[model samples]
Target: MDKIDKQILAILQEDASTPVAEIAEKVNLSSTPCWRRIQKLEEDGVILRRVALLDADKLNVGVTVFVSIKTNQHNANWYSQFSNTVKLIPEVVEFYRMSGNIDYLLRVVVPNIAAYDAVYQKLTQSNALFDVNASFAMEQIKHTTALPLDYAGLN
Candidate 1:
């Protein structure tokens, strides 16, 4: 991607709902070229998907907890089962297969601790986890859904 593409991405990350004409103005490009660039970006999979980010608190999913899970059985079958089971749980917002101290990390969102516990009970009983540890977020200092832009070193 060129400088204009990078600029377009940055603007879109901040607000995907931004008009093509506005983006063109911001990047000092004409509407047609700007629209073409955006189309190219999307076609090339640079711009993945556009989504509406909803407020968790307003949606009654105020509590967020990080759950770290470890399983003694590290086989492919076990991993597949675990992943499938976790995906079925709506409360689990994000799940990552990790390295080091944790095998898998899950970001869970619910109404409160009691609701979390209910989800927890369901998870453990699902035959996917051998051990699970959860940590609740006391305060979110910096939470961003945006990825960092490092274009300086790029050739």
Candidate 2:
């Protein structure tokens, strides 16, 4: 990838619906070449599927909760079952296995505290957890899907 490719990515990150001609003009390339670059980026898996950003408040799911989980069971079978259970839950937007004291971290969004409690109850019933902690987010200062292009090296 080169500087132009990085520029193209940055522009697409801002708005994936940006027309090829518009992106091409910004990157100082013709439409064909710019389109080709985008195709190559997709083929290389650098360009993942584009999606729309939705407003949580407008959807009435403004509550954000960070859930930290600790498990005594560290085997593959336990992990597989727990992962599957979490995957089936719509409120769990993001889930990750961590390298710290917590075994897993989940970012959940819901309409209210009662909804979160229901999710928590479901999780506890599905599996045996050593500990489960949830922290509610009071405010969101910054939120963006755009990643930095500086580390792309070519940029």
Candidate 3:
């Protein structure tokens, strides 16, 4: 939460696998203190988890589709069922309940239109939706997992 902690976070965000010694050097601290800070960050839930970023194109699931859904069913049972159904679908990488014209939104990744069609069919069959609209993303202009740290305002 201090300047040194923020610096450590910036370094870890850039590369989670960065050696403790290197990070310590960059942050102008000895290895032990820097490591302790990192450990504290993890224990405090600031560092949730470290993961490897995969190449979707190489994995044969590069195509992205944004699905907007509208549902008339507003009961808890219906919401629970629908949320569970969506969570079980592997193609649905991101799902959210929105407060707008659209009831829900999902970002689905698939290899081709046929695969997306299958996902669409599964969704429609599993839930009673008033409307479902999907738009294929032609390009990914900006995509990043790194979060903005300036908003924290502790640096």
Q: lDDT for each of the candidates? A: 0.90, 0.96, 0.95
**Tens-digit per-residue lDDT, 9-77, candidate 1:** 899999999999999999999999999999998999878999999999999998999999988888988
Clashes of each: 0, 0, 0
C-alpha lDDT (0 to 100) for residue 124 of candidate 2? 99
Q: What's the distance in Å from true for residue 70, model 3?
A: 0.8
Residue 92 accuracy (lDDT) in model 1? 98
lDDT of 3 at 46: 91
- Ten residues in sequence with the least summed lDDT for candidate 3: 146-155
Which is better, 2 or 3, measured by TM-score? 2
Q: Model 1 reaches what TM-score against the true structure? A: 0.94
Question: Which window of 10 residues has the lowest lDDT sum in candidate 1?
Answer: 144-153
lDDT of 3 by residue, 16-121 (tens): 9999999999999999999999999999999999999999999999999999999999999999999999999999999999998999999999999999999999
Once fitted onto the true fold, the runs of candidate 3 whose alpha carbons sit more than 4 angstroms away are 153-155
Listed in order, each prediction's TM-score against the native is: 0.94, 0.97, 0.95
RMSD of each: 1.6, 1.5, 1.5
